[model samples]
Target: MLAKGKDATAKVLIVDDEPAFRLLAERFLQQQGYQVVSTASVEEAQQQLGQFDADLILLDLALPPHFDPQHTLNLVPQLASRPVIILTGHAERDLALKAISQGAWDFIAKPIDPDLLAVVVKRAVTKHQLEKELLQLRQATPVSSPLPSLAGHSAHMESIHTLVQRIAPTEVRVLVTGPSGTGKEVISKALHQLSNRADKAFVSVHCGAIPAELLESELFGYVKGAFTGADKDRQGLLKLADGGTLFLDEIGEMPLPMQVKLLRVLQEGSYYPVGGREMQHIDIRLVSATNANLPDLVRQGKFREDLYYRIKGVTMETVALDQRREDIPLLIRFFLEQLKEQQGQAFALETGAMQWFLQKQWPGNVRELKNTLESVAAIAQQGVIRLSDIQLLHLDSQGGGADTEVVDSALLGGLDEQVKALEIRLIQQALQQHGGNKSQAARTLGISRQGLLKKLERYGLSHSSADD
Candidate 1:
């Protein structure tokens, strides 16, 4: 009467010397609806792995003929690119921790509790399946010719490229949504490059970065003597973008009054300059991008619904980097190649360094990963990058960003407890800084809005709300 695993095809390889332990583990995993492959030795496990793409491995610390825990743990990665859970006795807990440091996903102590084993194994297997799916999706692509700036081979990236290829030829308004570092602007540029107006001027305006009072004049321009500072005739983004594409970045931050004006432009395609008697008309395509949740903003009455609908002719969303981890290695290689071209020297990552990079959460997305690599490469000697080089930079020491608060020694409790405390504090700070706007806070924290909501619920801050 056991329930099947979510991923029924998930395979687990057990490498243990004890026959009884192996049998028990195999039966338990099989009952959990996983394909079990058992091996009496590491050699047999290696042979089986060559034939079976195991999603996870149950490795014993005391595998003969190399009974040395460290040596056996070192061989885990060589076995396969999968999660390895060390099987250890209560007395061997220290060795199990060492196994983790040596790259094992987790460990289960002897006299294993079936419930605990099920939980740990299920978690690891689920993660493995997700990673596998991403890999398969990437490999299934027969051809990959991403835009110059949009260098990704994952299925998500492929879909984005396909959408752009289909929609780029048309003059539709596109609303790009996602986290800040996810390259919304790059997609916007691609739209312009593929459009019929490729040669025309492509003007960009950041609605959030510009002040409310100045944003109006910045977009619509002012005539000579319109104001004290208006010395002569000046062109605005709308005028400059005539016969081309006008990209509005962070359009959700446009003031309500400015939103009304933008609506008029989008509706009538005509606007008079500041203090101008004559109206100017422009034929242009509109492409807007924002990290904020426009629908939520519309509901809050901060964003005009009519404007949102007008600007949202087509919608595209960029996913967070962690969600598409299969692209990490490709991105690493791409960045390394760029570095070589720029610095006139070849750079390479050690196996351990590559594994370390793959294991990171990369909250800041592609931008953070690129920055970390640049920092490490700058100090790496002889163009060889290793885990030590990364550790020396302490790039991940303060959560994931350079601006995060540093951990203080005065904080009491274990590492996990202190880290949890820091997370809570950071979430509180983010919420306060953005006035409880969850979407904005999530962007600032380099996480998806759903991720932030989950954290808020977990930390019992679900009631926190303001302009959201």
Candidate 2:
């Protein structure tokens, strides 16, 4: 039997045709604290599913008008997200095995014992709830891949692998610095896998993604009645990471106030819940990653220097993909192998496509390259990926400019004409304001110096500005 008051919200659907069994099951489940819904036929089960979100279903193998097993088994796909336990007789063991193949959770022989029914329903509901929670957790902290691996042979990667091997077993905090989408999280997962605490939970929190006002409660959790919707006690990521590793991605984006609280927790190894009077103690290995410059943020007083030093016991820097161009082919091959393993179909790149991939400057680094290949693989004809397949997915035009409008009453023309006039006026003003220095003018106009020069040449104003 399940612990009392734990499954008060879990619902179960009964699809048995027999009225006696349905009532017995429903009453037993309701007494067990689960919301129960009953249906007399597969047809009715489908209708009930539309209105009721069940965590588990008690599915009967045969129905009236058509005592066929396949007829009832057809409902399995409709309840794909829920667990369906098969109801069968002692003589129908073979049919129950068939039901298992049709995706039934397990079989309970009829006439059903109340004790057995209670046990099976409770177990299925508990398992389903746990699975749902894990799914929600994964959605909350979206990772690059379900199974993160550092797959590359670049010199930078080699150094990273060596350093990870040396420090992963220790309790020292690690700070991974790199541009966005360079697989910093993968390195963090690798560290956890290599550590002595590998068997424990590996929790990750994206500091930049969460709102500043809510970050404290999110990390520290809260007790029941702590806030508007705090219905029950919840474990925060720090509490969940006890005896394991906690990865904080985009740590530089964390607010100063949250940083102070986090620093205190690190120093004292204990923290209070958002509304609780008592402090909770925890033990965890910390790993932080960010693309932002911590030193610069500290200099500007945006980040706390003490917190920065506390987090960065050792630093590992990942270079941009362009700096390690040789790893492009290796990464491509690794990604292709993963696709083949996952889809059970081989995918090959055409020579021209391979050459095209090798030549492009991937500003988004490994992530962009992997995504491009995945997209190409999806559209490739006959499992052969071509250059055109990839090219068709990307826009040909590379327009650079913000949607922000310049609020100047002096500019007057059609939309395009007005935009062009505004651009010219802004360029001229910026140039004049900066003493005709093109670089300084470009900075003022929020365009790259090269982009500014291209615009000047296109507008026939190349000679209007003097060089720095």
Candidate 3:
């Protein structure tokens, strides 16, 4: 029946041996706008409970021939914060009191009352949700007054935080490059938040998602009747970000014409709206990011060289998940805490699950990890998230080969020489793909700009060559 209501859609699990009783209970619950799952025995209930979170458990106290109520009561604490209600045909007052004393939330008389059952179920779910919300608030609310520093014990993350702090106060055009899901946007936002212009707006634009035809208008805006659908005057992202910061994601995808326009905006600090007679001036700080090679695009004439130089006044790059595999454990703990707060479940990953998560070659990077955690959290039972709980949505082990092959092929030489050769090849490939943008090249290689610079120094490949 699964009726639709904002708060009435909590999940309910009904465990009873009587087929008729189960059917009637399920139907009544469905009509009340709840998601109902029924099982004939405690064993079946336990199995199903491991994979689905139940807001309330409706337990029939009279089990089959060999079943004991005490055995069932032992499993109650296993569920993550879920409340259970007892159901039985026994009319004795002492029996009901015993059941309630054994940790049942409420006892319902068998041959259930449909209307009364619905009201009790709704009240139990409401109470559970309120308690969960209060717990989350207590966990999330900070005790200290000062804003917490963006600190990471990992050397790689520590370096990034240091770089963010150093570059935040300046108006330098920063180019942040990283593989997909490597937290480039997080770093960018942190840069904006810690900067001198923190009081102003921070506008984010995904360059790849916009169609090329509308990108110009979206960036620079348009006057009324500028095009067939343009009925009203529009303010562009650039104008909206005036006296603030504009974050350009997937900057490598910006078409050459738009690159020229972006270059002009950076150079002149002004732009004219489409079909508008006047030029508008804006004060803005630009932060750009990409996961592609920009230098190669430049070599292919797909990117503007002048624009690359202008936007990369200062540069940073994020390390890939594979390169910093040691951080996976820390990340997993952080995500689990977040999921506990978000889903109202105090679930811990099983040892096998933790090992599986650590061993995965996360090509999709941090985003893949978060998604995996979310999936596991949704299906876990007994407050234990097991390896079987996660359904691996995608396998991207193939992408790790290029970097590995490059390293292995160069290992015959001295460490310095091998590293140099590997650096040269990666730089060439990245530059050729990205059109002479070092930031973009570094992203494709899964290394920071400073790391890329160190590699460049080892290979005797100058910054001037990357710009070319």
By lDDT, who's the top model here? 1
lDDT of 2 at 71: 74
* Root-mean-square deviation per candidate: 15.7, 28.0, 22.7
- Candidate 3 lDDT trough over 10 residues, lowest sum: 404-413
Candidate topping TM-score: 1
lDDT for 463 in candidate 2 is 66
Q: After the best TM-score superposition of candidate 2, give how far the Cα of residue 383 lies from its true spot, in angstroms.
A: 2.0
Q: What is the per-residue lDDT of model 3 for residues 1-468, given as tens digits with 9 covering 90 to 100?
A: 233333455888888888888777877777777788888878888888787577789987667655666556555434424556777665433343344333345556656666557666776787667656754654464322111323234677778877888889988989988899998887888888989999999999999999999999999999999999999999999999998899999999988788888888899999999999999999999999998877888898888888888888888888788887766766766677777778787777643355456656677888887787777777777577743354233222233432211111112112344655666887788978988777567557654343355456546776775452
Count backbone overlaps in model 2. Answer: 0
Mark the 10 consecutive residues where model 1 has the least summed lDDT: 405-414
Candidate 1 vs 3: which has more TM-score: 1
Judged by whole-model lDDT over C-alpha atoms, candidate 2 comes out at 0.75
**TM-scores of all predicted structures:** 0.56, 0.54, 0.54
**Residue 97 in candidate 2 has what lDDT?**
55
| Candidate 2 residue lDDT tens string, 231-274 | 99988889999999999999999999999999999999999999
Ranking 1 against 2 by TM-score, winner: 1
| Residues 111-204, model 1: lDDT tens digits | 7768667777777787677766765654454435446567777899989999999999998899999998887988999999999999998899
Model 3 TM-score, all chains together: 0.54
